[model samples]
Target: MILRLALGLFAALALALFVQPQAARAAYPCPGGPGPGEVQVGVSGGSHGVAAVPICDRAQGGGGGGGSEVYYRYGSIAWHPDADDVWMEGSYDGPNTAERTALAACNQAMGGGCTSIGEWHNSSMRIFRDRSGALWSGWHGDGGVHSKKTLADCSAKQLLPCEVLGTYSSSKNRHLPKPTARKLYAVGAWVEGTEGFDSRLYIASGQRDAATAERLALDACTKATRQRCAILAFVGNGVIQTYRLGTGDQSATVESNAKRAAQAAQANCKKRGQACTLQRVYDSRTPGEFVHDFMAPAAK
Candidate 1:
């Protein structure tokens, strides 16, 4: 009898050893059919490193294998070898509302798998790739990058007027898109000085040629100052040309333009009158490419 019992125990141990390791399970996803405000069970926040709970071992101890339950308002999932590093991600259905009906439903169907849920705010701005291979810029909130927000509705297909906003005293340090970008821009002058020409001197879209840039510059200056304006570009070897407009005398304008143009033509040139402050400036070595009073200096 003793020998038979020993053999049976040994066989049981072998069977236990031979059993396959239980595969790590994934979080239950929300059903696809839903409207804009669809709630779902997803990877919760604060789950960068948590062990996966084995389905076979759910009843013994509290689930999650001593790992803390993590919640996310939106779903963003990832997997890795280390149990502590495994994470699940998803959109939090509740942003304005506090309840998590969707998350509860998901857990109910999955035999009590649970992730704490919390709504997330605008996380970050990123470039999203759509199926068409085009890149769209939008804000990342708790509901993922394409979720809704109080200020802006990014859920729509296109992100229109992707301008930066809210850098002034009236607003916080947020960067909203235009028509918001336009609102945040200082009313006095978008560009440095030449305030009167501010409205006319808008930054043109796309890269501009020498002639085109010069023409636009003149347009802005004349619109702001109402004086005859000339814009010139450096062509190296001391050759430069100017684009001009308005009734102001060409002589003085060209003289000023030439003087300003020459400053740029010289090595390590900055402002029209500002000195080449550094001795070993990189432009001193490279030929061609000179700095003109083109784009306004960044605001302090």
Candidate 2:
């Protein structure tokens, strides 16, 4: 149980980073501006960590995914690794929001004058900090090259006692797709009840199977800031929907579109004559490949 608790705490920390679109880093995303995609929810004030953080571990699935590209060009990061080791990280759709979220989160965690950040599209970013508190950033379209550059950056600066602060892939980050592959959609979250992007709610589409789709979405949720991830649902076609049942159970559904999905969720909760709320709905509009699942070509 102790071991499980420890691991849960670790995952919580990861979730914090994964969903931190509310952190401090701003000026770094890029002069180019925010890219394509949608942010379902926003985060508010507070310092969050594992102890009281929101998360739920209900399920899993599998796949081997490596590398990411921001062909969507939408992720912006807010980061401040102050020389005193006071730092925080968050993500956003553009520089302004990224900076706002990062600063809010960072100040809450530990007061600092954090004012640095970077931006990447579907690509990756890595940071290395030295004992002196000096920091270097590495960016590349390729995750592997970006990683190597991070280490080389410390070397170039001759910054000893250097260590990696964190690594990031933009919001749409995912592996390159196969031409003839089944498309799947999946949803996951750190905490079960809270919905939208702030809860580390994430979706992965166009996977090979239910396992792969769930794995991708869960993996993305884990890497981003959130509570703890639970696999909400998977489907081969239609849309993915999440909700809070009248009994308070967290669940999801696959419908043909956004309106139908929301209506279906509402109806399900209504069956109990209890309170229910439609949390999130990812229809054809959500972005990414919307196509594989346990339900096969469609949901039953």
Candidate 3:
């Protein structure tokens, strides 16, 4: 009986060792045997779980394993005197390639006086001509460049009456067919009640042109308030500001059109024996209103 019992104990120990390893190994196996386009299973550490990896055939380019490919191309355009003779080239491997292609095409068609207007890579750009007839271009990377920023850039370069001519986008695969230009204007007003109140100010902007915008602002202030309104500033597509400095009926000046506006205002204020400071700066292309009291601080 003792011998039989010992033999039984040995058989149970062997079973435990053999069966445990087999069960663990079976938990994670290659879902499909080693082959192209097969699922590979791996055991995670410490009871975390099993993970499945995909096997790909690089030779056949069958599977990418969630990877993607990207290609970059450039676009360029050349402009001549005649609109119909404009030449454009796109989908080139390099910027110079697009530029050369456009120039070559343009020169081939219309002698040798061809100028490259713009170039872009995997993106878009817009061209504009200011009232001064200067060409400016704005580039957009993903969505597009902001119209305000583009206009501001042109204005900063002292290009007046700036307007967008057209847009070219690689993604769109074409240029804007029509001239989609918009005009921007800014205006400011100052008013004072003849009865008792001090000066009241208003600014209006984003009109089709400078004269209309100024007229609209002055009209609005005159009709809405009981005070007499006077035009302080009128400008087109640029920054404008007013300054009121020192105490007791401060002198005010409008800053716009020229950099000399500020210097003149400051000089005038200083002539009155008071320290003049900037009160407000305004953009005509941006529609808004501002109001402040110069007398309040003096009264205090």
Candidate 4:
């Protein structure tokens, strides 16, 4: 069993890691499952009775019982355990490109819900859904039975029986929901005081893009001051801190958390012999908006 697993994993890495596989013109059909282009399929290995092994093409000959002809293919699943089912279905096969592309699409799908999540690479992804409708993904190198082992692992953790969602190859964006067309975030402000220096910051989070985020922020500021609002800064998903110095300079920082950003900004201000006051703090996990007055309490 160990030898078989090692062989299969070797095949998966060969197909996915070394040279990029020739791009398929389109998805092909399979009878019972998701078809060649969809769920999974492979070559040479088919003669040996391997289903989704990607044909051992990347490595030197002599594997999967092959001596001369060699071919293997790789796959990646854009699976984030914390992601919603609708958000985790987008992915492709490139080694470095998979995670980045997946996150771009899924982040759009979930509206910046992936801030705290991480990513991964895998040759095969086994999807399982428990009776309660919670979805789980299992990953291993790649082989016909390799996917099965991962599926078993996934099933073991479930409180009930799981339904297999099929093993797939290459890039599969089939199930990703359309992005809400919402921008992630935007920050802006408009003047209001007699000196026209009201430093209050307004924000618009979860817009479709930077332009949208800024527009939303400015619009809110306009509503509040009944004047044209200018863009302060474009801050995205993270620990957002807005601050004002005694010198009347307004700035914001993006850090790991509210306190870190506040402290860093205050430290920077203190170096210049200026008073630093915290205007607002926004949650790093939140994909939403936050607003501020001209000034707020100092950081505790």
Candidate 5:
């Protein structure tokens, strides 16, 4: 009887050991199996494949054959006087690192003074332009709040003529492309503050041609002050200078050559006995080209 009892116990123990679930033998087993942001995918032969999954939380992590790892993502937008751009980054190792990375990328591509337009983790962003020519951007994890916030913010800023451009999701797309480069024309106008008049300054940019830009600037100035505004500068393919005389007389002369534009402006101002201080210069070229020609140093 004693021998039979010992044999039965031994048989049961062998069966239990052989049929144990593979999950019980996992290399890095959590007490509650896989936690949030984790999924157990079954591989062939009944082995549990640990994988990281996208979670609503800002920080996300996953498990794989090698081990567990964390991921970070961010999105951003930047704008200047005439253009704007967006950026996204992921696979970072620290908190808020993605925000800095995105900002750096945006500033590098769009030049300095770029703002931190938006940031997110496992989320996306969209931008809009209002009829009044204001720009707005918003971001959200699940794509619900962004639209509402974008419109609300634009309204808060009193931006009219608003329309959504599109949405960009890191989960669905790679990086957003750069804004299109184009030749730009601009106009600058300034009204002198006289005893009965308030001083005014107005600028219009990104016009297709110099004439159109000048017209727009003048119209804007007249609408704002109800007084005639003289064009201070015109830019297209080169820079031009405009000046106002002390006698309340304004003169506009276009020079095809940018090199002589400033000199010509000063000469005109001097001939009219003006201080030559009311002259303004404007550039009519793509921002990139303008930076290269003026901001960058001459080749040795």
Candidate 6:
């Protein structure tokens, strides 16, 4: 009996070896359960097959063989854990569909309350929601079109970075917000004692002295004039000149004596006036800028 059984097993094994074997499994199907673009048609089998299932591309290990992650592909984009689903959907393949999906996600996430969607942006979607829970779509684009004042959405609310970068300023203006600083020459001139004249005008980096202002003041007025004074204060775009009108057509004499008279006047002012009182010269130009005192109480 034992010999017969052994012979029978050998015959079966020989028969199996003669038949053609099945091909090995290839790459796992497009994640979610071997669908269209899948390598092997039906579900995987045995040790060579996929074991543990995935949760929306996330794997849950099981059995002796570790389970493989199942990724969901929307067009060319693939999403995984820790990735922004809304952004992925919005940025994938086509703009119309992806952007629409992204908008829906954002609107749903934010409570659907404010203004409607304004415009679609590269990485951002603008949905306007008011306190009343109304939702308006396509209001702001990615760079943020609408200027939102407060933070809140109606039905479904989504919180975004609080960076105002839209066409409105404080939700009141329609034009784009003004820039904080503009690249401009800001060309401005003031005679001696004028605008920035606390005697702290800097000629260049690391070079500053009160005498610079005094010198400028002395040469501000026209030559050959009775004026023999320095500019005490000049602001905006204007000039100042002082007069020491001597007796008669000192016009000719004044021009000739300008250098000497100016020197004398400056020296006299420094000696007679504490802090060197520089005289004020009259000006005719209108002011364009003004001095703003922002010093603290102690300094004031």
lDDT of 5 by residue, 192-215 (tens): 333223333356666755467767
Looking at model 4, residue 10 earns an lDDT score of 11
Give me the candidate number with maximum TM-score. 5
Which parts of model 5 are misplaced by more than 4 Å?
A: 1-72, 78-81, 91-94, 155-161, 172-300
lDDT of 3: 0.45
> Can you list the residue pairs that collide in candidate 5?
52-62, 131-160, 131-161
Q: What is the C-alpha lDDT of each candidate?
A: 0.23, 0.39, 0.45, 0.43, 0.41, 0.22
* lDDT (tens digit, per residue) of candidate 1 on 27-134: 222223123433332211122123211111121121234566633233222221111111222234333232244345334433344443232221332322211111
| RMSD (Å) of each candidate, 1 decimal | 26.1, 21.9, 29.1, 17.5, 27.4, 33.2
Q: Is candidate 4 or candidate 5 better by TM-score?
A: 5
125-170: candidate 3 lDDT, tens digit per residue: 5555432223444443323323334455454433133456666654
Q: Candidate 2 on 1-300: residue-level lDDT in tens?
A: 000000010110111222222323211221232223322111211111211111111111001123442223334333333222323333343434544554565555435534534333444455554322234455533224434534653444221224565555555332221222123334443433344324234677644344666676777766664546665554433466665544545456654456666765666667657676666556522446332221222322
List TM-score per model, in order.
0.17, 0.29, 0.35, 0.37, 0.38, 0.16
Stretches off by above 4 angstroms in model 2 are 1-182, 189-200, 225-228, 244-251, 284-286, 289-300
Model 6: residues >4 Å from true position, as ranges? 1-88, 99-119, 137-145, 148-300
Span of ten consecutive residues with least summed lDDT in model 4: 1-10
- Candidate topping lDDT: 3
163-230 per-residue lDDT for model 4 (tens digits) = 56454433455455333312244454455333444456676654435566667777788777777666
Considering TM-score, which of the candidate structures 1 and 3 is the better prediction for this target? 3
Model 2 scores a C-alpha lDDT of 0.39
Which is better, 1 or 5, measured by TM-score?
A: 5
lDDT, residue 138, model 4: 39
Q: Relative to the unseen true structure, what is the C-alpha lDDT of residue 5 in candidate 3, on a scale of 0 to 100?
A: 6
